[model samples]
Target chain A: MTRGRGFFPIIRSWSIAAVAALAVLAGPAAVPALAKDYSHIVIATEGAYPPYNMHAPDGKLIGFEIDLGNNLCARMHITCTWIAQDWDSMIPALNAGKFDAIMDGMSVTPQRLKVIDFSIPYTQSPTTFLVLKSSPLAKMPDTGKRVSLDDDAAMKAAIAAITPALKGKTVGVQVATIQYNLLHTYLRNVVTIRTYKTTEEHDLDLASDRIDAAIASTSYFVSTLNKPGGNQFVEVGPLFTGGLLGKGTGVGIRKSDPELVAMFNQAIEAAKKDGTIRALSLKWFKTDISPPN
Target chain B: MNTSNPFVLLGFGPNGWGASLVAGAAMTLAVSIAAYLVGLVFGGLAAWARIAGPRPARRLVGLYTTVFRGIPELLVIYLVYFGGSEALTSLGHLFGRSGFIGLDGFLAGTLAVGLIAGAYQTEALRGGFLAIPRGEIEAARAVGMGRLLMLRRVIAPRALRFALPGMGNVWQQVLKESALISVTGLSELMRAVNVASDSTRLPFDFGIAGFALYLVLTSFSGGVFRNAERSLARHERAR
Candidate 1:
């Protein structure tokens, strides 16, 4: 054992060096040739978001956006592969060319447009507050009513109506999201706002009464309510859309990929016309969220 | 069996995540092994430089170890994952390539963890070298052994024996640090478990599964290092 030990170290070190060198050479070596080839593309998604994009128990990605993405890709004549990505870094990764586009329920906001581009809106869902059924806040004002932030008077009135009930209450929303923006901009003075990393975390907090209420898209809440302990939660308050919420969920693409964005827009238009979007939305969300023509 | 049962859910059924979880564990091991090997190369070279190289070489290694060890592992990972691609893309532009050239997730993660692990490994290897008795080196020289011959016959063996335990500790560190690679979206064990839990809405079940798998890996690797240490020390015991 002792006789061979010294040689082993020398050989091991050499092999280690060799492996490191090979890894360095192989790691970023696959430079996607700068061609206008639209034959094959990779799409990224935050697979944790249900009814939009989510992983199945079998490790396959499936959901509303998955269906729509495949449909759009089919129409665009591109073979698209979907990869799960963390929500926070989705845009950066797209711009970095980690993937060609993002279809992870990403809303097209004016703030986001400054960085990346989006395809035409594929699905539009309203934002609302979720509360425990037993909580007094469950009976929030203007329940089931839609409030477009574009109508400043209606938006302010909706905020005013809910402020009195939410005063001194702690509300939860996912961080760095349109819902968080809405809360920070409008309800910052009224309620103590808490931010969470994911919608599921806030839903858990609401179920445990750590938060008086949680806010997220109505489509997301549909998945929440379908969960085992979700029966205890109820959606209240006016539905919010437009303005700060952006122009609904769309495929997030890099600004350099104008042709890809155009392709997606064309496919989406076809999908809407053919009722493919409506069918997928009904299958996943049980509602037609296809943007009105 | 009920699909809601934890065993069934983690089983190999059509709806179960057992296969994916196992695949993720394999990925975790692959990444850790690759990164550990990278650390070994960096650590060995740095140790050699710090001990015998010129003053400028030692200072450069010093700065590298300090900066890598000083930053948070997550930040290091982010820098490698995003920054690596950014650098590559710019480099491509320099070569008249217009589009992005991404650093593979597995590669970025391994380099990040390996670079961090290298800092700790450098100290361990350096200590191993320092702990070598001066007389042993002198004895090798008196025997008319050349530099490379002495290094292979005496220095390498003695230093490695001294460094075995520290190297073992660094292996453990590298294994745990591999979990952070999940952020790069390389489907490692943690990411698999997260996807499973989130998808099924059964965090408790999947969380326990992840906990068990990680425990098994750590304990099994711990045993391997212990055995390696024991084998390496056999001559001392015989004497």
Candidate 2:
């Protein structure tokens, strides 16, 4: 029964496409009638995804993505509009033609790449865990050291060491993110996972004791730790990258927008070479976050 | 686009969003109701001040209505969420407490919704007050009723009757404004829809579901308000 209904819409859309195709063959004006492309490129962000894109107290979109988007647009000589769209609706909205690009610090993982195209990464960083300062898990091991999950002995040791502290503990992660995927893959058996829409929400829940720990971008985790409210929270665990976490955050574009995608890629490359990307990263993240060459 | 798997989109199974969407709708109603009540309390005070209070009180009420109505609801939510916690923390510190004093999302969201609600409600109630005949108050006074008795016996009832329709409008405003609470990271309807959309990778399905849920809540609430208006207007001639 459901199959019947689904087939009807597909058939209907196909008929509409056929008609659109015929119209395009008739004239140049009909060509536009065949496909609707927006003039102003609308960029959508969560406006709560800190350092990448977040809302200012005065209700304006601010942060790294805002700056990067503006610079990229300027370099590409395109007129674009920025809007604060809810993070969850961003991809759907992009497909729905509500926006043209998504720059909400969204990672370009294989799962996401299946649904959309992402430009060359703008910023690359590792994912880390945030636990309360007083939590025993905070002192587990490997402070300021990078440990790849592929290193069998080190990974096994680290996992074993953190397992006791993680037992029965709730770890908060943003829903549908790489961090959540990582936690689900590596820590799901040992810890309970609670999903939130934005990192900010998880941060609030972590502070409120709704969750014992959170997994997020190291840059974002650092920002939270610096905030006056997150006094008790400290970054912990070895930073994880490459596998599930994706390469880095990028401008998520429609699969069809290759021209725009190329433009962004060029701007990103230029920005990295000119020190603009690292400068902005240092401004927002207080560290050089340019993607490794 | 594929309706073939309705269960896959909204199912209660491993892939279904049915349970999540339902829970989201329930939360939307809950937050809207809480915000509306807060607004009603604030509106009552502001309307009273506008009608019967001294000059300073009248001016203060005017300022509140103007400020809230003039600003966007999104800005108000931001200020309440980001600034509200800091304000509470300082207030807590004044009493010698050191830890963070979080205004829970529900309370912060309620305040944001209420502030916007109160702005519209002030006008609703003021219209209600004006609609009350001066002769009715005088008649209560002439019958040897004290100020409190006059208010309780005559003023309150008539004003409420007059305010019912306007209050209905305010209720709808509050219901829609509650959508903004999603920004505060509250797991209300919008936030829940967000989570479902992200998790499922079928945003169109979840978004449509969310839109339908909001419509259900709004239309259902309208029915309740219509009943309230009907009961209040029983003695009066139908328009």
Q: Tell me what fraction of the real C-alpha contacts between chains A and B each candidate also makes.
A: 0.58, 0.00
lDDT agreement of model 2 with the native: 0.73
Q: CAPRI verdict on model 2?
A: incorrect
lDDT to native, each model: 0.84, 0.73
Per-residue lDDT for A237 in model 1? 96
Q: Where does the lowest 10-residue lDDT sum fall in candidate 2 chain A?
A: A1-10
Best by lDDT: 1
Cα displacement (angstroms), candidate 2, residue B104, comes to: 29
Which tens-of-lDDT digit does each residue in A1-45 have in candidate 2?
Answer: 000021001000112232343223211111011122333466878
* Candidate 2 wrong stretches, greater than 4 Å: A1-39, A150-154, B1-239
**Per-chain TM-score of chain B, candidate 1?**
0.96
RMSD (Cα, Å) of candidate 2? Answer: 21.2
Name the weakest run of 10 consecutive residues (lDDT summed) in model 1 chain B.
B95-104
Cα deviation of A116 in candidate 2 (Å)?
0.3
Each candidate structure's TM-score, on Cα atoms with residue i matched to residue i, is 0.93, 0.55
> What interface RMSD, in Å and to 1 decimal, does model 1 have?
7.8
- How close to the true structure is residue A77 of candidate 2, measured as C-alpha lDDT? 79
Cα distance off (Å), candidate 1, residue B92: 1.2
